[model samples]
Target chain A: MGEIVLSACGLSKKYGLSYALDDVSIEIERGQIFGLVGKNGAGKTTLMRVVCGQSTLFSGSVGLFGHSGKRGLAEARTRVGFMIEAPAFYPKLSARENLKIYCMKRGLPVSENLDGLLASVGLPGVGGKRYSEFSLGMKERLGLALAILGDPELLVLDEPTNGLDPIGISQVRELILRLNRERGVTVLISSHILKELSSVATHFGFIHNGRLIEQLSSKELHARCSDALSLTVDDVEKACAVLENICGCRNYKIFPHNTIRCYDGAVRPELLNRELNENGVGVSSLMREGKDLEAYFIGLLKEGRANAQLY
Target chain B: MLNYIKADLYRIMTRPTFYIWPLLLAALPAAMIAGAGGMYPAGVILAAIPALVYAAFCLMALILTEHTFREDMQLGLYKNDMAGGASRSAVYIAKLITGILLLALLWAVCSLSCIVSASYWLGGDSGLSLLKDMASLQAASLFLRVNVFLAVFQAISIVFKKTSALILVYIAISAAMAYAMKWLGAAWPGLAGFIKHIAGFGAYGNFGAAAGAPHAAGGVALLLAPAACIIVLAAIGSMMFEKKEF
Candidate 1:
């Protein structure tokens, strides 16, 4: 409902004969951190590149901040900051010097608050160190520093916490959250670390073999993955009536083969089971079912692979 | 484009190689003058100055192009530039212009040394006059040759992304092309003349006598060849660069 910060529609990018991105469409609204979930070579980076204008598309369009077309997208991209793959800088130049180059290229005053920006990324006084001499964690921190240099409205970061230590990872996670909460910056981030992503992402798009298999918000994904009291009953109609009328259960879903799942209504499993059985809706089986984000993504990939084979 | 240019200037000027290369270039005249040791005519050394300067300029161009482009390609900095909203043509042209400006600085240092040496050895009035004459005679041709070499090499660097491969392939092609032109010239005289004129070799060979009585038609054609080559080569280079994916 908020202004769309990034909208990529029907994006397809082909390398040789295979598709790096196949008919992918994604949109991120203002202040949303959309995590691109996929294994390696699953089109996450390619999709990010296409959105950032680093890679040309075979068939599709990208609109940023409601701006489309060549000239418009170009002008729109200036408002976006991106760090794709490795953080690239002159190896000989210090982190501060590299950030200054970015400032100059973006036409900002060379005197922009670079030290403050570096400090914000947890790279406070190390700005004078050469990039070549940086640890991978430091490099990633500087990359973050560069991405936030111009106070961009949108940040397209690919694996921003890639080489960080555990504390560094938490720092980056906190930084992303703070940026989103404070400055309202829209982020399109991709990472192999799904758990880390789950902690920060407001929404997610699971990509598999160059196709986006699913897109859901954090709330929706939680609802799908949340613990559920599942029951297999003899009569589906009777079971639904008994659950609704007697047990005071309001949130539940009925599946095939007379199976039912109750979620989010505080319906105790043993009590519901006995109530259903007592109400003449023979309860055949009862158990709890749930999944974490990783399990859900793996299961989605498998399902997608099977469907691709079927097609 | 101006932003990129400014940034590139700041980067190159900060590096010590920018100053070192031109100083080496300026020292060429002194080195050659010491080696000549009063054996050859002063005019011969002066005439030979452009040739020595051209060779040094070529090396400088090669190093400059490698410094300007190859490092970026290897490190993937171009991705940062293009993603930051700089047009591809702007990045390419900005680099080319930076290389030219750096080359111009080298040219100025070398020219000043050549003039200073010429004045010291040949006396004031006559040395100044002769230096002025030779500069006018050689300026356009030398500038075009260096520009064409830089532009062509840059185009090659863009098209061929690998640094070692670019160097090996460029050297092989240059050697092969030189021999091919030589053999073709042996077979056909007019073609040889045309090749010589276009390649600027004839201008260098005839710099002394040709200064006062330049053939207007031939001179125009000579300038046009390299000038047109630069424009066409730059156009093709920029086009390829624009379509290149990070």
Candidate 2:
């Protein structure tokens, strides 16, 4: 594990009686792009708000840069930058002027390459334009610039690509990758765009109904999603008998119409086909089946709901 | 906290209201002088000027609050400050300080304009003498009133999260309390003395009596009401702010 930059344990926030965040605990190490995936109102934004100190925690502790107490956490936050929800700025003020307010607030010199920073975010030459004049994509780009304003060690962005075109999304993805690779900044980003998130995230956390159901590395997720081998046969009963007795394929599920899917990663498809054929079971179709990020999350949600129902 | 104050001041100056308000304030007296002419003596006119300016000062307090803090909750500026490592108390106090600073600046400008304009346009030593006599007490009264107004408006803004609602609620409560206190005080004489300290409306009589009596007993006695409100309201506001989630 790399050095842990952000950690939250038993975090919960409540509104009236409903829990916005229910005992969510997550840890993001340095140089890791941690992607938070959830449906709307699943507590993704709530968790980000709590971590950024925008909301008070009902119960739990958050440690940033190894700091936990109020003052320590506050001091730790100086090294962090975030952009949660819609990017808000003084509408009448120009983009540069809006950024200058933050610069002054953060004690950065007003002359600190604000135009260069704006240009870096793909907002070149528009720093003098009023914020209200900019399009939604421009606003999102400005938000990204603000998140990286202080060259922070940890960047927390909630739906950074919320209202952007395909080109804009790709640019944001490349920017995140470049920041992580070159500057070694840890990022905790939440997005509904699972495909975009999957492309950039080094780790994933799946949240459902305010609960974090699973957390895993990208490599582990890929392995879990690709391990299934689907097969079809002439006779389901004969194939199952041969697989159980000869091929030793025990971890498998049978579906209707003579189809079976094997979850056992050790079950070699070539060997199983030969064994089934020799045992007088004809093999008709065989292929590897894998889930993309979206399907994997949906399957996880289903399993989570099923387990919840079981208890 | 200092950084917040600095940033807030920068934003405040960017607004057109900051400049428009003072000019508009100065225009009020100019209009009075233009129309009233020699019908009222310089002494009478100059003596009445503080009341006019202070009344406007009260309205200016509300406007300043609207401009400075109206967008805090609406635009999530407080979120930016808190997320940048400022404590809630720090943010609240920073806003308080910013409002107070701007109010003082406006007070200075208005005071100067009234004094200089009266001296220039309203002739004679009588007008100047009248202003000098009432300056200290009026300043004190204005200071206390403006601070109290600012504290109450800020508290309302933070708790309610709506600027228009803040203005309406403040006006409603002030009016309601004034009438209630008058009725209650008339029916029960003993409650008047104690009730006067309970609300800011009780201080209205002090401003008129305080004119020309540089250090009047009424003015000194009225200080306790607003000073206490400033402290209590600020403490409550800060505490509530600390508990507030964004």
lDDT of 2 by residue, A1-311 (tens): 67889999999989999998899999999999999999999999999999889899899999999999899999999899899999888888999999999999898888899999998878999999999999999999998888899899999999999889998999899989999999999999998899999999999999988889899999999988897889999999998887788878899999988899988898888998889888888888998898999999999989887998999
Relative to the true structure, candidate 1 has a C-alpha RMSD (angstroms) of 5.1
- Per-residue CA lDDT of model 1 for A1-311, tens digit only, reads 99999998999999999999999988899999999999999999999888878888899999999999877888888989898999889999999899998899889999988889999988888888899999998998898887887888999999998999999999999999999999999999988888999999999999977888899999999878867888999898888887888888878898988889988547778788888778888877998787878998988878777987999
Docking class of 1: medium
The RMSD of every model to the true structure, in order and in angstroms, is 5.1, 4.0
- In order, the B-chain TM-scores come to 0.85, 0.85
Candidate that would win on DockQ: 1
What's each prediction's clash count? Answer: 0, 0
lDDT of 2: 0.83
TM-score of each: 0.87, 0.88
- Tell me the DockQ of each model, to 2 decimals: 0.71, 0.69
Error of 2 at A264 (Å): 3.2
